[model samples]
Target: MRDPDLTQIDPSRHLLIAGPTASGKSALALAVARAQGGLVVNADALQVWSCWRVLTARPTTADEAMAPHALYGHVAPGRSYSVGDWLREVQELTGRRLIVVGGTGLYLTALTRGLARIPPTPPDLRAAADARLRQEGGLEGMVRDLDDATRARIDLQNPARVQRAWEVLQATGRGIADWQAETPPPLMAPDDCQRVLITTDRDWLADRIAMRFRAMLDWGALDEVRAMLPVWDPQAQWAKAIGAPELVEHLQGRLTLPEATERAIISSRQYAKSQRIWFRGRMKDWHLWRAGNAGVHPLPES
Candidate 1:
């Protein structure tokens, strides 16, 4: 698809660029930033980690030099970061012309739809939930107990989602969905922003995902993962970068380089597929740009 002429949009409106991985989201955001001044904020869940640059496909140093960027690679691997944490950070930046971009659907949902001000789960409760997720027939067992409202609200196939719902239900005696229903006004209501969803054909995105993984290797992803081995905790949020574990497995001699590369590529494709599904479901009102395909057009000026 042809690239959307994103620069033509009203400069005063906040821009939101969301898409699957490897879908030129960063580049488009940079274009919008240069043409229409704004602070380019990071909304990707993984890109916040300081330990990953290549594997997470973070904006290059050169890219950051060209625009004012915020919230990328600022968190240490050990810090506990959540959608709430990200929401608070973004809340502070609402006064500025903002160009928020990422593939993380949860972050965008929290920003535009309003997130529940749910209390933090206690450490003991969190630990117990984590333990149960690992020991008691896995997340599938836990999924069976979530309230019907939360089951309808969250992706049950995701272990992290299921575990979080379980913890909320166990600790608060109320479903996460109940909390979400009571959410206050959003930081950026959809009507106030110019949102763009970049949709790519599956085969095109698959090829790009493979190429980007190889590019990450060429740009020293392995070296980065190697430095992480001494302090790596697979359970940490930072460790969830798409290719980090596969590359770490390779460095640990658990898999050959070729095997790791293939596995990582496959994982990335799967992640992109999930991202596409999520954006499609949640962003029905956003402007749809058929990226990596032909025939893009300019939106009529409002």
Candidate 2:
């Protein structure tokens, strides 16, 4: 029962395993890499942060030992790593059979169609934007000011996202949307690879999200976030991790550990919904796999 889309991929050079959070992408990708002598690349945003292993559900040390992995937990906390940086890393790893696994649609899109090369915003411009953000109300103001195209793609509720966009505009004297329209270079061509979006039942995924969040907490997600607080701001990319805000509240004595854990679970469920929607709308052409379906190929053939 070959999936119609499976044949379209260059089996030797590319494979993409994507699904909602906690959908076993890491395990599946590891299996594929081990089977085909491929490299498993981290495509998830939070997995790139150095200090968020437990909170972000990053692959464990044992998992890394199972196969070769790249770009996982390599970035310093609080530093922003753009899709462009991801694309460049992928290109540098060229010629290897690669299995990119993650739930971050933006990173996957950058890999497939190429991203706009908006250069880094200067520190002064960023500082000015940060100041303006604090003064002109906040993210709401930035969202209202942003061109519709840019606003549509960015997570408006995230002040960091809003601030970064403003900084780019301040430094380049052009909108981020306009630069994106120019297109940098495709990270990987459509014809060169196969992409799969591993879809799970909504209710099933919701349950998985809840379970995973609780497990992360049990594994000391709070302590990881707490340790990062000295150097990481709540708005910084790492601090804005999936379970971070809720954990921050717990740390501040605002929420009990149980209450914070519950909130984090709820947040993860909501984020999974967002990821599912983003995949449907953005990667419609990708092959689909249900979470529990056994017919879908499992990698690392026995």
Candidate 3:
């Protein structure tokens, strides 16, 4: 498909750029921001944590200096940062055109389709759900017991999502599917924004992921992980970041540097594959730009 004429887009509307890791989505977003004088807002979940900018591949200081950036590394590590928290933060920003870029599908989904109004899961209930999850070996049984529909919809392998559904059920006595039926209006109407999903061949993406991880190591990602180790909580969301856990294992003397590097690359490749599947399924109507294509740039009007 031909690339959309990004230069012709209204500056008042937001731009959403989503794709797999290392897919050049961030570069495309930055190019658009520079051309349109837009604020680059972060939609990537991991990039929101303040403790590990290098590890997360967050925009460098020079990049942020060129254009306004928001919600990148704003949250302290170990804090529970949810999609709703991200939605709230992004919605609070006013004025300026925005180029929202990230690999987090749920955050993008929340922006395009309104989030559910499910009440916060109580702390006690959350603890109970966690305990049950550990005892049950996995969340499949809990989710199946609580809400069959949610079980079908959720990634069964993701303990966090499954636990969240179980917590919602225990707290509100209503399934997550029911709560989703009460979602609010989207923050940005679909017609008001230009959405693009970067596409790359799987083999190319895998190579990029491997190279990026190695580059990250060269750029002090291991040191970044070491600094975060003092505050690392195995249960915390930040600890589960792609490279953090593997590096933690290395730091703890459980794995060699080469072993950690290999594992991290494999994990990243798997994640990118999942993200590609999600973008293809969820963003069918969004413009698809091939990775490395010059067509992504905004051209001067005649």
Please provide TM-scores, in order, for all candidate models, with all chains considered together.
0.93, 0.87, 0.92
* Local error of candidate 1 at residue 9 (angstroms): 2.0
Candidates' C-alpha lDDT: 0.84, 0.76, 0.80
* Of 1 and 3, the candidate ranking higher by TM-score: 1
lDDT of 1: 0.84
lDDT for model 2? 0.76
The best-first sequence of candidates by lDDT reads 1, 3, 2
Per residue, candidate 2 scores C-alpha lDDT tens digits across 106-190 of: 8998888788878897767776676777775766777787877888877788776678777777678777878878986677787
Worst 10-residue lDDT window, candidate 2: 293-302
lDDT of 1 by residue, 1-302 (tens): 35547544678889888898888788778777877789999999999999888778888887889999999999997878999999899879989999999999999988999889888889899888877887858788888898998988888878998998898898899999998889999889877898888888789778778877887888899999999999988887899999889999999999999999999999989998888788878889988776743233221000
> Considering only N, C-alpha and C atoms within 3 Å, which residue pairs clash in candidate 1?
1-292, 1-293, 1-294, 2-293
Root-mean-square deviation of each candidate, in angstroms?
4.2, 4.2, 4.3
Candidate number with greatest lDDT: 1
Each candidate's number of clashing pairs is: 4, 0, 0
Candidate 3: stretches off by over 4 Å: 1-12, 136-138, 294-302
Instruction: List model 3 lDDT by residue over 73-141, tens digit each.
Output: 898874677899988888877456778899999899889989997888777887787778888465667
Clashing pairs in 2: none
